[model samples]
Structure formats: C-alpha cells, structure tokens
Target chain A: MSSRYSWGADEHLVVQITEDMSLESNFKAMAMASDLASQQVDGLTDICPANASLLVRFDPDRIAPAEVERIVREAEGRLEGGGPQVLETRIFELPVWYNDPYTNETGARFRDRHQTPDKTDLEFAAQENNLPSVEAFIEAHSGAPWITSMVGFVAGLPFLFQMVPQERQLEVPKYVRPRTDTPKQTIGYGGCFTAIYSVRGAGGYQMFGLTPVPIFDPTQELPDFTDFMFFFRPGDIVKFRRIDEAEYNQIKEQVEAGEYRIRQRPVTFDLAEYEKDPDAYNARLLEVLYGN
Target chain B: MAIEVIEPGLATSIQDEGRPGYYNVGVPPSGALDLYSAAAANALVGNPSSAAVIESAYMGPKLRFTEPAVVAVTGADIPVLVNGQSAPSWTSLDLKAGDELSFEILAGGARIYIAVSGGIDVPLVLGSRSLYALGAFGGFQGRALQAGDVLPVGVGSGRPGLSVPEALRPQFAKEMDVRIVLGLYDYRLTDEGMSALVDRPWQLSPVADRIGFRYAGNPLQWKEREQPFGAGSDPSNITDAGYPVGSIQVPGGIEPIILHRDAVSGGGYAQVGTVISADMDVVAQSAPGTMAMFVPVTLDQALEARAEARARRAEMMAALS
Candidate 1:
C-alpha cells in the first residue's frame, strides 16, 4: 500500500488524498471518509474530512494503529478509478447584509491588527482582488456557490471553497494579529475560503458581512437544527444572497421570534460533471436552491 | 449534602475521561489534562477510572464538605490541607462533616486533580461529564466552579487506603523530553528546521492553557515552493485540515503551538508533528517556563510506550484491589 498519510500519535490517522486544495481532492477525501464510516468500525470515534484529507480518531487499545492504516489503504485502493459519487447534500441560500453595522463596529475596534487598517475589510479585499469597488467585490463573492470543505475551527464554522475558476477565486490574508473579540454571526473571509462565526469568541478572519440567520443553535430552537445544533455539514453547498438592511431586520425579528426558516433544498452533487463544467454546474446548483 | 466552593482557584472545572466522538463538529474532548493523575485520584477514593474529578490549574479551590467524604488529591507538587491541617497527597483521607479543603501554591507542574468518593454529579452532555467551557456545556453548570457554587457527588463504591506506588507516580522534571512521531506535514519543513525542532530546548510560554501549549524556540525555515492556490500566503499555512490532538504547528516558525485536548479539531496551519500518546500527560504537567526537548521516535516505540502505560494502570488497580 502507498504511504499517503500521517499518523497522529497512536490515536489518530490522517489520510492525505492530495497535497493541495482542489475539488477533486476534497471529493476523494469525502468519499473515503463516507466509505470508512459505513464500515462501522468499532472503537473508531470520528471520521472527519477536510479540504484535501481526512482524519480518523479511534481507541488505539481496541484497534491497533497498524490495522487502521491497513483498512484505510484498502479503502483508498477501492476508490481508485471509481466513478463520480452521488453525494447526498443540501443547498442553502444564506441571507447576508454585506458591510453591516455589527461587523463594521467589531472590525473598527481591531483596526490595529488588520493589514489595511485605514480601509474597511471589504475595501481592502476589493482592492486586493483588483475589483473597482466594494460593490463589485460583493458581486463576485456572491455570484458563485461554495462547497463546505470542512466544518470545524469552532463548532458549526464551515470553511467554504468558491466554485469558480482558479484565477477568479478571491484570496486575502488573515489579520496580522487575531482580535480578542468577534461578534457571533459575522461573515468572514480569509485565504480562499469563507466562514461565519458560529459563536462569538476569538477570530482572525477579515469580517465582510453579517448573516441574520443562525448557522448554529445550541438549544436546537430552529426546525433545521432539530437533530443537531449545526446547520451545515461537510459537503453542503451554500450561496450568499445579498439582502437589504430592512430585510435583514425582518429576518432578525423572525429569528428572535423563533419563526425564521433557512431557505434550502435537498440536492445530489455529481463531482465528475462539476470538474468538467464548474460554471454551468454551479449555476444549476443555485437554480436547484432558488429556482421555482 | 454536597461540596460547596469557598474560593475557586486559578481555574477549577469538572473533568472526566472526556466527551469523545464529537471533534467533527469542533467540540473538543474536554477532560483532565493529566489522565494518569486523575485516574490515581479516583482510584484512591474508590471510584472508577472515568469518575469525575476537579481539575485545578496553578492554585486549587477551597471547598467545604457538608457531609463526610473520602477524598484524594493528585498531580502537581501542591500541599493538600483540611482545615489548616496538612494532609498527605496521593493517599485517601476521610473528612468529617463541615471539613474545609484547600491547597497551597503549586511548587511544580500546572494542574492538580481532586477526587471525592462519589464523582461530581453533573448532567452529561454529548455523553460525558467533562466541562467544555468554551461552548459552556457539560460539567458543573457548564462553567468553572465559582465561589458559593455547590457540587453534588455520586454514590461511590470503593473504600479508602488505596494509593499508587511511588514508582508508579509521574516524576515532574524542569527539563523533560517529549517524544513525537513526525508527520502530517513535516515534509513542509526544511531539513534544518526538522533538526532544529529536536535539537533545541523549548520553553513553555505563559499563555499556555487547555486549548494548546505555546512554546518559545528557535525560528525554523520551511522549504521554498510556489505557494499553492487557496493556501494562505503564510509559509506555515495549509488548506485548513483536521488537527489531531497533540499535533504541533508553528504559525510563524517562531512559537510552536501544541494542540491539546481542548484544541480546535481542524485548521489551516501546517502541523509538523504530533506528541505521542504516552507523553501527552507529561505535556499537561509541565508548568510555564519549564524547558522541553522534542525526541523523535518510531511507531513501534510509541505503541510500546502506550502498552506500558496501560500496564502501569493495571498494576495500580491491582495493588489497590
């Protein structure tokens, strides 16, 4: 078996499908993790997939690390030349008020830690991406759908990879120093990924907007969060839909009243077609989420 | 009747074996940092290995027991006192009703474990009684023990007089060797960097906590390569991936941060290596300013070390039984 992974102590095994981030690597990791989970291997606690790899945590006493390596290699071999997997996923339309007041207040408080303290995070990101203005940057950001590459820095925080061509993807550095405070529900962007602050704590990502809807409800108050506190799982698709402050306020009210419902649709993701025609495929994904 | 907190120490929280199986959602397995010490305390008090215990940092909590309790204190070089009378540590002692328990300043190590006959009777969240303070779930009221807070204990089954052998107890050292099985992105580091990691002595930073232990050491260099797309500009950054407990990552190649039990499950930084399971408890015991030396070992050695640890625990239990 090929050695394409790393051992984390005796308790964890990480299988690196690729060295870099790409949709193909992410899909491979997802497929392998899904296959391993189906095995219901005893003593295995978690099978977590990331951007280009997956990590398995288990009781070493119950299942030897060597055995884990053997099983993973076998599963990886089985997935070679395998056809595109049909992934059971959900497409969510998230409402965002870009450059909202909450984020503006928090970002301004941590200006000393930012790269471009004089300009807002949106302005800096726009200029870095060569966009004419913040509005244009917002358009580009919301134009494409993003896949949930991983869900973990903190609970329910999904790292999203944009579904656009390499050149079209936006990139930005994190804060020079992380802010001690970050408001919950703040939409943030760093590197080539996007995320929402699930719970207010400490964060370094440049804040871009604020989402009115909740992505994590620890109380399980929302219907979508009945079974779990987290709304988005790994491999879920999300599209950022711009909303006006008025609509944001309305949604906020509904959320407070516990009557808000996140707009989402059940969908199946085909990786092969996505690799061939990313643009058309992304458009169809959005259509499935928002189309009548 | 239950234990009442008169004063919470630097940081006192309820911990057990930890809530596993939820790292995928970013929930860390918040438990006693020093598993051996915790198990020793529980064993002394006639509780199961997984029984709840109070994990204290730096200082220890002052508690008033409303009812008599069989108690034991383990970890760190701190004195255990009952109503101003010094009591022996690592040995079970019976306390009468209204007996007040307290501790002295830590002479060494960072954490101490206090176990009562009955475990802390807190509602289990996600299947463990350990405290996840970051998310405010599990443990006693989902937070650290505060002044005036009351903690009920579970009905314990074992009797006192059980103590681990002196040879079995962990020996605290100012300078220690922490073994690692390098991988998960050690390839990103240059040969010099890899050598620098094991060759130098690293001092634990003052900011060390449950989430991670930050160490100050020589800045290492990374292999030069065209930064990949989606990967951040930082030389130490990768496309965010799952972080294994005990994994070591250097954000700027200056301070090496070792992820611990409460660490985030996944992130973007390139991890250079992971501390072997046997030494993770040692890492927890090291106090700030203590020096640590990284030692590289093979998988077979790591597995052998783990087996030794299990055998040691079995020996302790056998001696008590």
Candidate 2:
C-alpha cells in the first residue's frame, strides 16, 4: 500500500468499522498507511490512539473541512497493506480476585429469569460447580497479548483491542444504572472488551475485577505518555490467563523489582458446559458478580 | 509586592492568556473571563500580553499592597480606594509599601482585573497561571484567592508609567455587546433553540463562580434530540466528558450551564455554543441578571473577528501612552 496518508496539515477523518469489534484482521489493514497519518490526525492528538480505523481531526488554518474528509477516506481505504505494520507486543498480566459472593436465584424478587438455583449451594463454587475457575482459565490461556489502538475517551485511557474470535463476545449494552460511586482501578467489561475505570466517579461496565496501577500522572515530564507503549494494535489477537493470588503477588513483586518478561499463549476450552466454554466464563463470572 | 486582603472580595484567582493546545487531552484553556481587561491591565504595567493578573468577581477585594508597585485595575470598577483615597480605574499608579487598596460591593459588572507590575508570580501549570479549580490543579493550589494569601509580585518596577484616556475611561468600563460564534452543535437545536440563543435575551444566573456562571431565563429546545434529561440524554455517555471553560452545556434543565475557568476538560452534555474567545472576558464581567444574547457565525468569520479584536486590544494597549 502507498504511504501517502501522513505528513499533511489538513484535517483528516478515518473510521474503523467493527461489525463485532474483535476482528483484528480488518484493523491491521489500515496500519500500512499509518506512517503518513499526521499526528494532527486522530491518534496523534494529545488524545489519539495507536491503531484504529479512523483518525479524525482538524487544523483550520492548514486545511478546510472538506479536505479533512478526503484524507481520512484515503487512509481508511489503505487498510489491506496493514498486516506488516504489527510490531512488538507488550503484555500485562492483570491480577484479579474472586472473593465476592455471587447470589443464586432464591426467595428474592426477579428469580424467574433463568434456571433453578443449583450453583449457589456449593462452596468454592469453582470446584463445586465443576467449573474452571477464573484462575484456571487464565493459567491455560496465559501470556495472551493486547494491542494498543488510538487513545480515545478520557485522559491517558488507551483502548487496547485484538481479542481472539473464540474469546470475543458482543459488548452487552452498558448497565442501565451506573454505580453511584466506584473506586479507581475498577476492572469491568462490556460485550467483548474489558477496561479499568482509572479513576473514581460513576460507571456502567460490568465490574469483575480490580487493579492497583495508577494510569494517570501529573508530575511526569510528558504527564501523558510513559514507559507503556500500547503495543497491541488492530489485527492483533489476545487471550486472558487466570493467575493465583500468589502468582499475582509474584508478578507485582517482579514489576516492583523491575523485571521484564514476555510470552504468547493461545486460549483453549472444553465446550461441554458454559462453565467449560472459554467465552462464557466472563458472562458466568459477571453473573456471579451481579448475582442472578 | 502582595495584595493583603482583609476580605477576599468575592471569588478571586490568578489568570493569564490561558493554557491552550491541550483540549484533546481533556483540558480547556482557562484564563480571565474578560481577556480584554486582563490584557489591558498587563499592558498598562509593561508586562507581556500573557502575564498573569488578579481576577475578582461581584466585588473586588480590599488589597493592601505590602510593597511599592505599579498597578492598574480594569474591567469591573467596584468602589475602590488607595490608602483611603479613591483610585482611578485603568490608570497605572505607584503605591507605597503600605498603600491600602480596597473595593466595596459592585454597583455594576461581574468581575474586575487587577494587574500589577511584573504580573502575579504564580508558577505556570500546562503553560499558564490561570487556576483550574475543578481538578484543583493550577493557580494557588487551584483554589480561589482568599484573605491572607501573600501572592508574590514581579520585579524591575523602578521604571516610570503611562496613562489612560480621561474621556473614554468611563465608557470603556461600561457594559457592551459581546460577540460570539455558535458552536458546531448549534444546529442540534430547534428553531426556537437557535432563536432563544440570540433572539431571546438570557440573564446571567445568580449562581456564578470560578468554575462557571450558570445562566437563567429562556428554555431552549432541541428539535433533533428527544430526551427527558438535559444535555446528557440517553443515546450518549449520559453524564460524562469534561466541561471546557466557556462551554454552555445544559442537562435536561431549561437553564444552560455556562462553564468558565477551572472547568473540567471533557463533558457529555450538548454544548449549544461557545462564548467566543474574545468575548469570554466580557462574559465574565456580566453581573447576575445582566441580559446576554448569543450570536452565531461561521468558523472563518469567528477567526476574523478574533483577529480584529486582538488588533483592537493592541491599539488600546498602546493607547495608554
């Protein structure tokens, strides 16, 4: 693909269409012409992301409204050559705990939604339900990678894409009622993607986990970009591996001690039941979190 | 030099040309509400056009200068005096070490700009000294100036000064029409929404502060959007996004929320229009209940108007000689 998209003063708007979001192949298509994409365009704004279909922005003096439209359309069309653009991948193993209780259908209201309450009677629900715990799933699918796209919505919050098709799920519409108050490092997800609410306020994503990393900084030189280079981009594929608390603490210790490590792992699943289906784990966990 | 406040007038803070170019990161450039008056005061004191100055609202504070310095008060003119003697607005004056500067409750206007020689010495955050009270990050700990705040003054004040137009001084202090550009989302409203923005005179809501001034009067309708809540109706993030300084975001409420300095960077509510950069200072000075009508224009026209206003300010800066 010709690299004629970047190095312009004109406003450009690029759109990344995702019929269902986890398709990395289409996203990788645009990376070929990214070199020409002006930082003035979408991902380069103090807020743009690294890999996305569209990059839209305007510099009124250098280009007009119409030019912005033309340039972005050109950039979007050059996606086929995007495959070679995938570079190094950076992986972060997030640590999560499943201590919260998942209520079962009982004598309470709204119990008629699904099956009889069989899962809630067991302790160590992971073992009792004869299901793979989040930790087991993560262990089997460990080292799955994540790619960075353009930075969009909120400050320093990068949108990391590239989920495996088998692992991908349609993002459920956000929760109708947002949590009145949530704390920072709150990990949650919608349909096929996951995110951590970096700071506290109101949020609607399904909350399944938490992290301790601070995503924003005010004292850094750039105060924006840092040691992290959202490595995953469009067309990248990733899996999530569950780690035990001990493993998590070890990684935390390693991170604190400045140890760097990386590896790639694919996901696997036994489809006998949702407890065994890899894709259904998130929904099950969410069911536990919200309680059916 | 420092302005010792027995009472911090109303709401006060340090502001300058404002920090620009960081909007995409969710940061709005915030500065004096009245850029015209702030620039005028800085120019009068021989400081750069971007130097920081005092922003006072409703009634200016009782500032007792702890050191001798040249100063000019512009924008709103509350009853002011130096060492018990009435001081002239817009003109530079040399105060002794113990000169007492004070202002009574305002008779008119919403704010006043006090620029001292060398400008207010607050450290620059994101390239401006203007306070962002929302995140509480910039300017005097990102809070309003209060009594006993000993703000540092600039140096090299031994040089002499200039004067203001004796005839035009009063007229310059008077309220006037402020130009604006309807925002990109302007068309998202009904004909009535568009009309109420300009045709109907809206009054400054009594609720005002460094964060922003909430406007009252005229319920604008969005013919295109259907919702029970104001700006953050359903189809969107609901109630998110940072509020840029000078944005008018209305929720489901009839009245509009006019954001000002110290505003959040992003917001989800619909913004009908932005108080054009040039008119922001004027907007800051509109007292509660003052009538305001927003006018719409294209981007190019807005740029041209801004350039003309900049040239006009340069002339006024030179006019004091």
Candidate 3:
C-alpha cells in the first residue's frame, strides 16, 4: 500500500509506478527527491506548496515508485544550483484541551527531571505547561504550518514526524495492553508526534485526542475502484484545528453507525479468578487467554 | 438474485482480493485469507477475481439457492453438500432454486471459500466487497454473516466455465511448512532464536484471523538488549515499523505474530520474517492447534517460488478453461 516519490519540489508532482520491494527506502527516496523538487523544473523557482511527499495520498496516478524515479532524474541536474529554499517548517502551537485533573499536584513535586538550569523552581516549569486545553498548545507554540514527514503504513493513521526537540520529552511508550480497536478519528501518539487512526482497527500507539471528522470517505469512491480519493501528502502540513463538541457528536454518530471492525472478539475474565491460581492454569489458560 | 441464509455456520462474510492502498490512513487491506482458493472458486464459476465470495470459517453457512446459478467452493476443505450429497470442489455447479447448500466442519484448513458465478452483489465500500471487521467497513453490514443475512448475486454468470479436469483442483496438505523471507529486523535475533523460529514446529493459536494468527510454542527473544518500542524508546526496543502481511513479529517474547489480512497498518514489534506469497495461502489454511513450521528462504528463492506458483496456477486455469 506504500508508494514512493522519485523527486521532491516545493509542490509535489503526482506520478505513478510499479511498487517493488523495500518500503523504508522508497519513503526515504521520495522525501529526498521532493525536497529537491521545490526548485523550478527548468531554472525558475516555483512558488509551490512547500513540501515533498503526499504523506498518505496514493492513487493509481499519483507518486508511485517508477514515476518517482523519473521525477528524481528529471529534477536532478537543475537542483544543484542555489534555489530559494522556501521550506520554512511552520511551528504550530497546538490548542490543547488539557484534562489533566490536578494542575497544582503536578506542580508540587515535578522538579525531579526537567530543570531549566537557571535554578528556578522546577515547579515553575509545570506552570508553563498549564495550557488551557490541547487546542491552546497548538495555538501558542505553532506559528506556521508544520512540515510532514512519513505517512502511517496503516490507513488514516497520520504519523507526523520530527517535532521540536523541546516537545520530544513528551513522548511516552504505549500502554501495557493496547486497545483491541479504536475509532477511525481517534488521534494517537507514536512517541514521534500525533496521528489519527482514520479507520477503526488494531493499534499499539499511545492515544492522545479524538478527531470525529472522517478523513477517508468510502461514499465518495462509490465502488468505482479507480475513483477512491484519499487526501494528505507525506510533506503536507496538517494543522489540527479543534472542532466544536456539536460537530464531534455529529461525526461520531455517523462513524458509529457502520464501519469495518478488524479485531478479535475480546474475551473477558474476572481478575479475581486469574489471581487465585495464576500459574496453575498456565498451559490450558494460554490457549483461551491469547486465543492462539 | 439473492441467496437466503438459513444457517450462518461458524464465522462467515463476503470478501474479494482486498482494499489496497489505504495503509497510510490506518486501514488494513481486508480480504480473503486463502487468496488462491478464493480466486479459484470464483474462476470455476466464471466470476472475476474481484468477487465477493462467502468466507466461512470452520463450518460454512447453509444457503438456499434462490435462482438458477453457477457456483463453486474451495479452501479449508470443509466438506460441502447439496441436499446431503458430496459436492465437488474447484469446479462449477449449476443449481436450482429449491437446492439447499450446507457445509460441515473443515477437516483440513481453517476456512473455506464459496464463490458464485455472478459474484456477490455487495455495495462497494472503498472499492472492495471484502469486509474490514475493525472499522466495520465493507461486506454484509460490515460484519460477519448472520442467520437472516441474504446475499445478492451480482450480474449473474459470465462465460461458461470450462469442464474441470481431474488434476486441476488443488489439494492442500493437512500439515505443511510455511515459507518465510527474513524481515527488516532479522538481524536483531540471536542465532538460537532464529534457529527456533525456522526449526521448531509452532502451533497456531486459536486467536488467529484476518488481522493476525498468533503462534504458540516459541519464545523468540532478541539477542540484543530488549528495549521498549519508540523514540527515547528504551534502548533495544524496536520502533514501530510497518507490519506487512505475513510478518512474523515478536512482542512480550511470549507469542510470535503471523500478521494476516486485517493486520494493523503499523506496529512497534520486531518483525523477524515474512511468509512469502507462495506459502501465505498455507498460513491461512492452518487451523487452531495445527502444527505450523516456518522455513527460511532467500529473496531470490522466494521470487522464484512465487513465479513457479503463478505459472502452475496459470497452467491450471488455462487447462480448466
């Protein structure tokens, strides 16, 4: 399902090709080429979209592996000269609706790890993090459109890469037991940045927010195999604007009605029963517990 | 034409090849597990490769033919019968409106494919008739077949199927080896771990499906220090790379994951190998408690094997035609 772009420019040129084997290499190659393509096809710089790959957008006609190679070759010679690199990666201050319960408690003993070296009370830094909501964080820190990196190999799951080093510390490992399945609009954290699982399916990434708006529409394609339209590019900037609760509910209702479910039926076991003889039923229970 | 569902035996749904090109948006390419068998079933009945076949796990659904139609049943070796008579597999059959079709427990594979000549008349969701059970897209109401679920036969039969010869129907083995190609993180395993992966016979976990088939009897661990998956991810943890179909991934060092059709678009586990396309059908056929042995092959060998399989399949199709 993953395709590669051969060349990079400020605005991405759609090409098609037969996808061969190595996936990571194809993604890297497209990113490299698209970066170079921002320069003019001839010698003139084009004021095009400042990005490389359409992170998640792939159609029969778009940036496929074969076409990517040709694009790379076509734009290769002229890119060596100085071109106005218009790629100013826009920093977005995400507006966060932080629901963290105790802002005061978090400030009390938070002085352990993150110290500013000014000897200022580390609790003071927690106050800085006290953005009103998730949306507020987006509003303050990010001044410009963000640069996109790779798309999720999974559908609808946007994997935004290369967040500022300061935000790097916010990444954390996923929960011990991942959810069996989540909604399509469920935005998750992969420790790299935020991504929304555009479809309901299995995932191991840590969850952060919920975007009820359906990004991938099955109705639009309407069974015409060739006409399915999926938007978003590898280098495309995705600005997360907070939707109102009313909008969220409307989309949520639609999403809940019908969609694909890709998970095993979860079997529930009482914790008390398992605790009684955890090791006694290891062999027999393994078959039932893991369903393997 | 609609076929009335009398008894939706075991787990059943309609599937075609799959909905490809949606991994970027977190969608798994939901489709048939035993792809060759599914296609073979459709071809025998003069349907295109992309038809919604009835994917019945274990026991097949009981359907009452509503019109004169052509059909075939393949995969998983579930003993099928029409009015209590043994039915042929991988061959076309002409049925009447009064005929009742049913199946029993599969003796060999975990599932069997039922393809009608006209193809299943399912609403195209994202350009596929296949069902994605997670997001609940495609197929009969985007879920498994129910007692009252009636399937539509789309566009009736095409060209008449050639009389199937004796040798054309594929005979799947009760127990077999699944071929694998070393994955991106194959280097992370210890020699012993790799040896166990290929040499030992692992049992297919009951917890198997289109998403993934968990294997028991193997505790494959990384020779290197195991790290939590992610950036600043504990040193030694494998980052979440894309988990392709047939990927043999290890997480928690307890069970090995054999990813399948409905697998997540990505994962953080270490993918040690991938079952080659040539043997992916075999993996789909392995039933719960079935012994599964993994054998390694080089990239060149895998390609050659695939080519050979394609050629053989083509020859069969041509012969039957």
Best by DockQ: 1
lDDT of 3 by residue, B204-279 (tens): 8789877889988867666656343133243224544455566777775568888887877554555677777677
Which consecutive 10 residues in model 3 chain A have the weakest lDDT in total? A43-52
Candidate 3 per-residue lDDT, tens place, A1-292, comes to 3333311111122221212212222234343345544532342211111112222222212234344345554553333343432322222222222222222232223323322323222122223457555444444323222334445555444555432323322344443345455445555554544565666655555444565545566555322122443444454444454545565566456546644211122223222343355334222333442364
* Candidate 3 residue spans exceeding 4 A from truth: A1-97, A100-148, A166-169, A181-184, A200-205, A220-232, A241-292, B158-166, B225-229, B232-236
Work out candidate 1's RMSD over C-alphas.
1.7
Per-candidate DockQ values are 0.77, 0.10, 0.13
lDDT of each: 0.88, 0.53, 0.57
Q: What is the C-alpha RMSD of each candidate to the true structure, in Å?
A: 1.7, 9.6, 14.7
lDDT of 1 by residue, A1-292 (tens): 2337889878899987776788878887888888898999998888888888899998888998888988888878777857657688889999999989889999999999999889999999999999999999999988899999888988788889888878898988889999998888888998888988898989989999999898987677787788887887888999999998999999999999889888889999998778789899988898898887
Could you tell me the TM-score of candidate 1? Answer: 0.97
lDDT of 2 at A164: 33
lDDT of 2 at A90: 28
Model 3 scores a C-alpha lDDT of 0.57
- Candidate 1 residue A146 C-alpha distance from true site, Å: 1.4
